[model samples]
Target: MTGDVGRAIGFAVVGALALLAPLLEGRVDDRVAAVGTVAPFVVVAAVAYLSTSGPLFELFARPGDREEGRLYGLASFSLGIAGLAVIYVAFEFPVSAFLVAVFALTVGNLGQELTARYTPDPAVGTSAFAVLGTIGAVCAMLLAGVLGASVPALPLAVFVAASGALLGALIRSVLFVRDDSLVVLSVGLVVWFFLELGLAPTLRRVGIGIALTAALGYVAYGLGTASVTGMLTGVLLALFTVVLGGFGWFVLLVTFFGLGGLASKYRYDEKLDRGIAQENEGARGGGNVLANSAVALVAVVAFAVSGHVGVPSAVFRFAFAGAVAAALADTFSSEFGGLFDTPRLITTLRPVAPGTDGAVTWQGVVAGLVGSAIIGGLSGVFFGLNAPGVLLVVFAGVVGMTVDSLLGATLEGDYLGNQGVNLLATLSAGLVAGLAALWL
Candidate 1:
């Protein structure tokens, strides 16, 4: 009975957090409000009840689950209060308010994790995070009830309850079970903002651009081949900017995508580790002509479509094509360098053994050049560039690859985590490409 009582209190706290936080952000309204209010409290109650049942708790949350639950609830409630305060101070309604709301919710959620020290179990952790979010929503509404007596209190209260219940039970299914996929989705969301808001009006052009880049991922993950999700992300970003009247965006996109492509493809056959060792880890191989060819093919398609089809039609096709080209070129050089019988130091043509970082092989060099030519040609086709513009993009890719190698050999590893390295490299390549476009 004591255990039951503690569990109930814990659940009530979680419910409070979930219900108030989202509403304070103005994300909750009449429809979403209902589920939001009632769900959190009910979920807390359900989880609490299960905690007192030994087998049930063990099956769901493991040993110390009950204690962990209590800590999580309390932390959520406390943080939610803090978040509400922050929201009140941050800014006016709509955008600023939304950000503040999200900010508070995010902070409170992080606080719960810090306070509880719960292990990273996707099923348990994510659900708990969602519940923590609910607490923030509830708290916000409660504050409103106290201060702005004009606000309807019942709706806010009920919304908190329902959202908590649904989120508590369904979070595992919605986000936790496929954690890696969730990360990927999160990355996409982040990328979307970079393209849409950071760049400009090009957001409308994003549909095709996103589809095309995502297709590259599908080819790699779904079809069992290498891919460059990074390049795709970069290209989509730049193209979105370009469409929206962004100046000098093209250079950054091309240079970075080019460099990222080269870096990413180094271990074409290996799994995406993204761990620490990836700087110089994995087996290498020969260049893939088929892959490089595809790169060129995509680049050409994009350039032609963008120049001729108008920004709307061309944006997606061109961006996607560029991404494909970058992916192919990068993968070809990286993998091929490993298989070269006589690798040479990229800094000096002196012979070095395969597997040496920053080493270039004859086959890899050839593959990189071919990749640039094809992708650049595609750009030419779209932009209707004379020989000079076409040559410039190709030159950018070739030079960008070398610069990428230099960065890889020296500075990039220190600043960027595995993923950050990829982003920086792509940015560099795109910058170079844009400059070349201007000059030639």
Candidate 2:
């Protein structure tokens, strides 16, 4: 048999054994069960170490990388065990849920390898693997429910499958990391996180989330506003926003995306002549999507999990808007800054060339304010934010925009890229709004 197949079969056998923990909960400590699940990986690592240049080494290692595969493979096991431990230990979720997560996730990996081998097209293989993995995960979750775990089977199944598909794709395609260890950690962490938060999306909510995200993502991809990977990442974020944050949050996110696309497309020729066009004619790639929206995604997710953090739900809601507001503000500040006025350095107040980093214009600042006010007004209507809250959102947005400028003028060109600056600025805005919600 192939080494890959052999390794997968090994995982299947171990995963099956580990998943019995829930059934044995009355008699065995779950922690002990976790250790037992991890123990095999240690044994594998030892074999990889001692069996260098032998058949066992070949079994543990992928071609070309040889022994290095063992490192990633062990790391994958460690991360998976740790993520499951967090769910079952720190949060004290159903041991069955934890064990099932372990089983379902690795099973999906095994399934992926098996399915990918015969598929000729890489794209088809990926899609098939994701579908098969989702089916396997759903089956595992539903079966775990029958075994008496307190998990919400169908809802959890949909979420876990969606998350796994996206995360598995992300770690491999976008992040360019070793997926063996990290996919398990990241996907399992997100899955268990939802379980811990008790954020159960009704079937209708899930359906709406899927429908809206798919439609918008397809539109965006068709319009050249986002690349294929960009569309997937955006859709995943939108799904979480729609299901967890509901309409109030989802609308703001959509508005933000719309606003960014419009801003990028406006007067494209003029910006191009100025030698400051958005890179790649404003087509957002995976990195761009992640950099720009990571803050908003975190805000929405935090809002969903806020009840456990002792923060009021409204805080995360406002933070979400503020994050988008800041992102829009930055987009407007950059895209239109040179169209109407002479730019000045934000830090020095000295006249500077248009497109110069950290340069600002009166028109751009006003435009940014308009963007923030739009978000604030929507927040009042959708979020039921009082006047003060609306005002705070605007304030926080301005703060975020300013942070972007300050970073751009000083560190952006020299120390950080535009994406990095955008991330930090948006995060600052989000934190400011969250804090303002708490204090003011």
Candidate 3:
């Protein structure tokens, strides 16, 4: 208990000390500001290398505190350095905004640790931490700005606080299951993304993303379609589509989600009896949600950042459609393919069990193609994709599913996880379609 409080205080102190670089934001060049943000972490990392088993490691966080006995503090220093560089150099945010953003993220992280340690209920603890952290961050940011930190617009301040609270809560929920440093870095990047969102779209669109995501997430939770973490995780992914990629992309994702969910629910009893059902009665968890959508998120972000014109616009549009199409094709292949009794391995063409990895059936192949066409046709309507673009999207989806089966047959069970295969398949589909559009 005491350790938790001590760690919280340590975070607060370190976060404050880290602000010295940002204070140089206006006084120096942006590149220099970026370099300055990295310098402190470099020094800390050296000291950490020299004294891994010593006092500072134990003070912030030690190995075995999170996952696989990893040193989260060292992880934080390394990731933080890289993340701050992107924020300072790539984004070129003003000093005040950078200071406030980092302050909110750091405080939100520490607050979660402290609250979770002392509070009995995990849900209650995290919620309280989010609320209290928001208050602390807002007040402190205002005070800092007033005291020569930097001037901040009221709306920007609010955006920073909301991003911290919402993204912090979502990230904190996963910390108990994995390493904290990556989670910390994720929060930083997410907050950065959320902050940048303010510049691109209207506040009304942002609100629409938040409101609709919350509503759908709550409905999914109430309908027992997803576990708590799954729903929360989906909310963030949905926001990325809606807020960054626009309505067309968001609707395509919804189509994939709806179809995939229906397919999972199809023949549930038979799959369970055969010992091939999705885990937890098809209720999605964080891993399941991330596996299907991470590549889509990347595509959406690329589209959002590319200014939505010319070949790049066409490329990302194809990329987004291909990713969704691939995801749906894979889902259809898995859920529909399992219905057949004898399946042939994609690599060997030998008979395998109904649910065997790399197993493909004639029924599954047709279903997968149909799934891809549905998305491809929708892409034509939504993204203004012409005939060639639509065909390319469908072809890319088929290729992605084939790649998925190939990987599953070869490496999935022994060397790679199922989720990793899914991510790779979507990535490949996006790359193929995007590059094709780029070249021809």
Which number leads on TM-score? 2
**Residue 40 deviation, candidate 3, in Å?**
15
Scored by CA lDDT, what does every candidate get?
0.41, 0.71, 0.72
Which TM-score value belongs to model 1? Answer: 0.47
> Per-residue lDDT for 215-278 in model 3, tens only?
7666666665666677666776786688777878888887887678778878899989877788
Q: In model 3, how large is the Cα lDDT of residue 194?
A: 55
Q: How many backbone clashes does candidate 3 have?
A: 1
User: Which pairs of residues collide in candidate 2?
Assistant: 76-181
- Using all chains and alpha carbons, the TM-scores for the candidates as numbered come to 0.47, 0.77, 0.71
Residues 1-440 of candidate 2: C-alpha lDDT, one tens digit per residue: 65676876665564565455444454468676656545555555455445445555555455534635444554455455555554555565655345445554566556667776777544444444445556666666666566665556576567656666655655555543345555655666667666767767887887777678767776776676776677667777888888888977878887877778778878888988887787777767777778878988988888888888888888888789888888888888787776755899999999988888889999999988888888888888999989999998888888898999999999987799988999998999899998888786
lDDT by residue (1-440, candidate 1, tens digit) is 23433443333344345335334334446445444443454454445443454544433342344556433333333343333333332422222122223323343344335434545443234334444544554455456555432232333232322233222223223343213122222322332232223222233343333344334333333332222222223333333334432233343334434444345555444423322122323211112212232333333334434544444433333333334344445545655545557777777767865555566777887877777677667666655656765665666566556655665555555753333433344444554554344343
Better candidate by lDDT, 1 or 3: 3
When 1 and 2 are scored with TM-score, the better candidate is: 2
- Clashing residue pairs in candidate 3 are 64-69
